[model samples]
Target: MEIKIIVDAMGGDFAPKEIVLGAIKALKKDRNLKIILVGDEKLINPLLEQESSDLNVEVVHTDQFITMEESPKAAIKEKSKASINLAMQLLAENQGDALVSAGSTGATILSAAKFLPVIPGIERSALATVLPTARLHPGNHGISLLIDVGATLHCTAKQLVHFAYMGSYYVSHVLEIPRPRVALLNNGTEETKGGEVLVKTYRYLKEAPNLNFIGNIEGTDILKGTADVIVTEGFVGNIVLKTLEGASEILKHAGRYAYRKRLTWKVGLALLSSGVRQLKKRTDYSEYGGAPILGFKKLVIKAHGRSNAKAIANAIGVARQSVEQNIAEHIGDSIIEFNKQHRLDFIDI
Candidate 1:
């Protein structure tokens, strides 16, 4: 199947340059993948000459671009021609199978939630991202899908439960994990540790039939691979995500400084260079591509704001995989079944 993906060329900090380079790389990789670049043709077209510029890739002209500082709702309402808005509109119109953007996170989420209908029984879409872990899979390093990384800042216990179901289904279907273990992120492992909502969610997950609930896990357990899927609200989850990013940066700077300074430390680093490179690759954010906004009618991936060509290509790959895996269809069906079994009335948000 030819998986068509809409790329917001003007959305990110590097913008059309990195995005175009990434799109070209992705197109070269998969012949069955088609790319629709939404941005200013005047700026994006010339870059096509730098690569293959094959018919598989097309550009939709739009000079409007939304910045990181812009209000998401206002941008969506006013900037009708903005790359993110137009790309999403194209997706809503069935012009593409999935959409990937390194643009404003808030704008992407708000626009997707507004234009694209949420899956039945889903109140809000959750950002589900895969983070590296210590354990290794057969062909790849270990990764767990962390739900609600930054989609909805505040979530009700019911919403967190919904995220848990969505994350479980995602890992099971996409990651091919059988009955993947699910864990709630809390301050402590004890059932009495978290606040009212966390406590309530713990009970909900524990009592839910068929869920491989393994009790609560602390922040330290994330990279230790304590659970297959970690479920939490966006506010806390985003903080955890950013903390990992900051720590990775600090380690990288320290490693550079150590290598440039003492000869003894440099010699030690040289001995472990191979292992160090492997570890860095395992922890790199680009390996997992971008985070997907789960519970949506269509697949929408949110890449990092400072994504490069490699990252953008990987994000496109993630979108392609999600489409091929039928992630949206599975989530929709699974949510409906879950609501029916739980006797919870579905209400449109």
Candidate 2:
């Protein structure tokens, strides 16, 4: 299948340069891959020439683009021709199968909301990141899908249930997990914890047909790899994601500190160098490519703003994989089935 992907060439710190290089790399990797780069032609076209410009690619010249500092609302309104906004517009127009952007996440999400239609019965979209876990799954991958990493911060129990379904289908499709175990992130594993919203969400997911609900899991249990999908509100989910990111760096700093303070510690780290490298490789956010903003008709992958060419290429691969797997269609089917089974207007029990 010739998968078409739209790239926001003006996104990220590196902008047109790295983004153009990454798109060329992806094109060279897959002969059937077609890419549309949206940015200023002067900037992007020159980068294309720097790399292999003969690959299957097109440049959609746009002088404007959203910056990280700009608010999503204002950027979309003020800059209709902005790279990120135009990328979303192209995806909505079926100009591409998927869109990948290392731009402002807020701009991406808000633009997606304005352009793409949410999956039927899904009240709002959610941002999901596939985080590393301690144990490997049937696919031999140590990762779990964490939903609502920053999309819909304040969510109701009904919406969490929507997220659960969204995350489940996504994991099953993209991660190749058969019957991925779903769990609610709460203060405790007990069904009674996490106040009324979580409690109600627990009950709803527990009874959700075709869902592999595994009850609740604590923050400590996240990396334990007990569950394949962790469902939570954007606020808590974002905190957990960021904490994990910081904690990984903290461990590195701690090792360096100990190495400087004690010769014995340095020797120990040297002995465990292979394992340390492995751990670092597994925890690296760049390896995951990008986070997928789910529930939209067309998939939108939000790569890190500081992404380099390699990371951008990986994100393109993820977007292609999702498009090939028909993730959005499957998720919509699941949501339709869920709404038919339960009237989740609000779960206030």
Candidate 3:
């Protein structure tokens, strides 16, 4: 079956040009892919012309666009025809199978929740991203799934439990991991660490039969490939994510300085170029594509804010895999069954 995706042409910092170019690249790569470009026609049409005139693409012109600094609520309300809002509406109405955006994270999440129905037994949706782990696993790219990377700022114990199951299922099906191990992010490796919410969530997860609960893991455990799915609330998860990003940047700059400052370092860099390139690829956020807002009715991918053409294309790849694997539906049904099997009142918001 053909997988249709809606791309917010004006959502990213490199709007229309990079976004459109990426969409065209995706369409060329996947014959089953079709795209609906949402943005101003004047800007988008010319870009489309640069690509092959004969591409499976549709354009939806909109006058309004939400800027990066604009308030999500105000932008959505005032700019009803905004690219993000309209793209989401199209997905809800079944105009497409998935929606991808490199726009404002706050605005995209707010609009998606308002526009799409929640998966059964899920009151809130969480963002899940594939992060490159420090250790490489067989037949994998040294990557693991990180959930709640900043969707819901605050969450209850039950919500973290929900994120665990959803993240596990996502990794297993989408990433093709079998029985992925799950862990809770805490300050300590002991079972009794973390705040009240995490402590309570640990108990719930431990008792959950379906999940492959592997006990508690600390912040340092994340990049070490300690767990398949690291479950935490958005606040902590976001901090960990940004810290890694910053560290990667620092490493890149430090390597450049070291190479220029010493002759031996220059020779070492030339010899290690292959390894360094591989390491860079693994750490590059763009290579992982966008984070999926799990537990939603339709597939929604939140691409990075400064996403370029390649990043946008990779986000489309993630969305395509998700649709093919039927991840959204599986998570909805699995959560319902999990609640029933455990005899717990989890569906309550």
Candidate topping lDDT: 2
Question: Which run of 10 residues does model 1 get worst, by summed lDDT?
Answer: 340-349
Tens digit of per-residue lDDT, candidate 2, span 52-100: 5468998888899999998888989999889888888999999999999
Estimate the TM-score for candidate 2: 0.94
User: By lDDT, is 2 or 3 better?
Assistant: 2
lDDT of 1 at 109: 92
Rate residue 92 of model 3 by lDDT.
Answer: 96
* TM-score leaderboard ranking: 2, 3, 1
Clash count for each candidate, listed in order shown:
0, 0, 0
Q: Report the C-alpha displacement of residue 154, candidate 2, in angstroms.
A: 1.5
TM-score per prediction, in order, is 0.92, 0.94, 0.94
lDDT agreement with native, every candidate: 0.87, 0.88, 0.87
TM-score of 1: 0.92
Which residue runs does candidate 2 get wrong by more than 4 Å? 136-140, 344-349
